[model samples]
Target chain A: MTLSPEELKNFLIELIRTAETRLPVDVYEALKQAYEVEDNPIAKQHLGAILRNSELAAKLGKPICQDTGTPVFYAEMGADFPLRSEFYDIAREAVREATKLVPLRPNAVDPFKKKNTGDNTGRFVPWFEVEIVPGSDLKVTFVAKGGGSEAPSTLRMGLPIRGVRNVWETVLQAIVEAGPKPCPPVIVGVGVAALSDQAMALAKRAALLRPIGDRHPDPEIARLEEEMLKAVNELGIGVHGFGGKVTALDLHIEYAHRHPATYAVAVATNCWAMRRATGYITSEGKWEIISKHITG
Target chain B: MTNVYHLRTPLSEKDVRKLRVGDTVYLSGLIFTARDAAHRKILDLINHGEKLPFDPRGLAVYHVGPVVRRKNGEWEVIAAGPTTSARLEPVEHEFIAKTGVRMIIGKGGMGAKTAEACKKYGAVYAVFTGGAAVLAAQAIKRVVDVYWLDELGIPEAVWLFEVEEFGPLTVTIDATGKNLYDEILERAKRKAQEILSRLS
Candidate 1:
């Protein structure tokens, strides 16, 4: 019962479309909370506009943002899955098709050649990061990482002796420098301990994967997230950098064990759109697409 | 005092200079889109002593890269949202003065030079809601024309759009040289210091 390429392509298109047009449940809820709690009139207006934009995009089944962003997929495959060899090509085909059907903005550009692939497909694009799980099914999540938010993400390397405080300061500096450019109230994801690229990727995953207000299981990490959120909101950068009390809707932290002498901190932020969707498929091509906002 | 104004494009000094920080503006009429690549091309054209593809005076230039789809043989805007303006900060002052565009639409703030250019050249910078691409597209009445679609590609092409009430744009940098983003940065820096110090 191997999944056919046509079936996989169709599922991927649906996944991309859902990710583009709708906000996830946690993101939507946090925005509503921010709108409710915002004290500044200007910030309130910006939040209202964001809510309105979300509403209209949902209604029209159109893209929530103009910059549909870079489509990033994280896949978990059962070790026993039969279609592993064909999955990559099928996914690429889906991205090209989705560019036309879902009308995702063609964002891939050749750095040296200055060429636009036009269909949102290019070398190493619709980027995939895969893991093998024990289950006998495939699970994939799509996150449309918009450029404005990604622009302000940063990584700071510190001496291990500087510890968590330095990481905190770096996060604060990143947010302060980012100001209102990444769009607020932004979700801040902090990755500590891992080196460079892995740290950055972990930071992005923390930003994109974790649900708003979902505290980490570890008490220290949870406390840091809470403090980070409070500190960011106090900066008064507000929505659209206009100044407000709800600058950051949520802050998440993920960490990995690192070398004793070096500490690397990565900070990644996501815009309020927070576009993502999840899908599950089996060898027999039984597809289940579940998006929190769409369903709830 | 912040006032909401209905600004029709092909703006004037009087029209733009009077705008202040935090004023809400609804822009109707014609506007053009240009990103970094298109800006480079337009500036190159000017440097080469060639005529611009379109008139820039009194018109608003949006720093955007839109997603457009072909519908019924016509270009339909799927989502047209503002991109970060800081990427164009180096060239913006020159671009604004040379082109004589009265309004610059983008998100995130530009630099002091751009603010100075706004003051010196009778131009203003406004921020459209970032990530509101689909909502912004609703205001675009039609795609009037496009330039450099092939040479520059879709996102980099200069797209001329006929828009009606195309914004909930907040004037962040005004003709008098005041900038909301800069003011916020100062406050944010002070506030950040306070937070960092207390945390330490």
Candidate 2:
């Protein structure tokens, strides 16, 4: 059976609502753990406040952050899925509806005109990147990219001769410069090896995709993730950039093979409120929203 | 050491002068909101010899563009979290000097100039935990008025609010010219250099 356009739009609308209001369970748990162990009194209080804020937003049915963020959707659809032609339109429609219903701050502006779109829908907004999979099901991950976190993302080309350590150094420098700006304790997503644009994209996706505390499958990458997290936490930036024991809740590193000439490194940071959610649409058009902490 | 303060708005040099880096302050009474556009507009109004919509002496300016929802014909704050203050660095020193704003609330550290202005103007730079929008909104008692809503739009408008215990704000830059961020980054840079050397 083909997925109806109306069903797809409604599913996406619900998906946006849940993603905005709820903090994923895993993210919340990591934050709680950080709050429990944080030695600095100032940092500890900040964490407590964050947890309380999330609880309040959920209870009141409000957007978790005032900056509801730009809704970025990543979708994977089975090639056999019949709605390929209409999917993009439905996604944009869902976002427009969510902006009104959730009353998302009108965030989209015409860059050149400097005009607020009023509906949070503008040129190329509700950006979607799709990958066609081999299956018959549709999976979508929604990332609400906040201005504060996105402000600190960086892309740089490290000299090939300098090797992987250069990538690490760059990532460290970026995080240090970002210091308390991207909001802490933040999750760092490092994307290595791809070209500049692709590397940044991968880093952003990694920031939103990987569950907090989950490491890369490859042992080497996993080891790097562990090392980076330790180094970052040691920076003493702490929660909200006030000095603390836990500067970062976790570090995620994802890599792609690159041209032999350059090793491009990109770091994407997400604030303590890791605002993301994943939804699946079945062939029968059933909508399933999964936030690992909330559902799993 | 950290100190907690229950300070009211229309703050004086004496009130802000006592605040030091790392001190926690819960600001009460009136606070105004402004972002990039509102900042520029205020500057323009000052230049054109027009009176500001609100009094600036001893005012606490929060750098935010809040999401406000209308309920029962009145505006209610949905999420009123702080925005990055660094973006205001270009004009902030002048803003403080010209307007006499005694306290600045936002996330991210302001620059050296702003810190210097804080000292010279007897002001303080405080950080409200970023992303704690819902929590921040609860402190706001009500929206008193707004300016430049049609001109600069909702998020960029200058919104005046009466608030109570409106912060878990850390005074990152205190009136005595001490900046918490500068100190933290100094130690951070030194420590980072040591780590990088070991790695290399």
Candidate 2 structure quality by residue, lDDT tens digits, A26-57: 88999999988988888888888899988888
Calculate DockQ per candidate and list them.
Answer: 0.80, 0.82
Among these predictions, the greatest DockQ belongs to: 2
* Residue range B1-200, candidate 1, lDDT tens digits: 27999989899999998899999999999999999989899998898999987898999999999989888999999888899999999999999978999999999889999999999999999999998887789999999999999888888899999999887899999999999888888999998888878865
In candidate 2 the C-alpha lDDT for residue A250 amounts to 89
Show where candidate 2 strays beyond 4 Å.
A293-296
Q: Tell me the tens digit of each residue's lDDT in model 2 across B47-94.
A: 899999789788899999999988998999989999999999999998
* Position A281, candidate 2: lDDT: 89
Error of 2 at A243 (Å): 1.3
Candidate 2 local lDDT, residue A236:
84
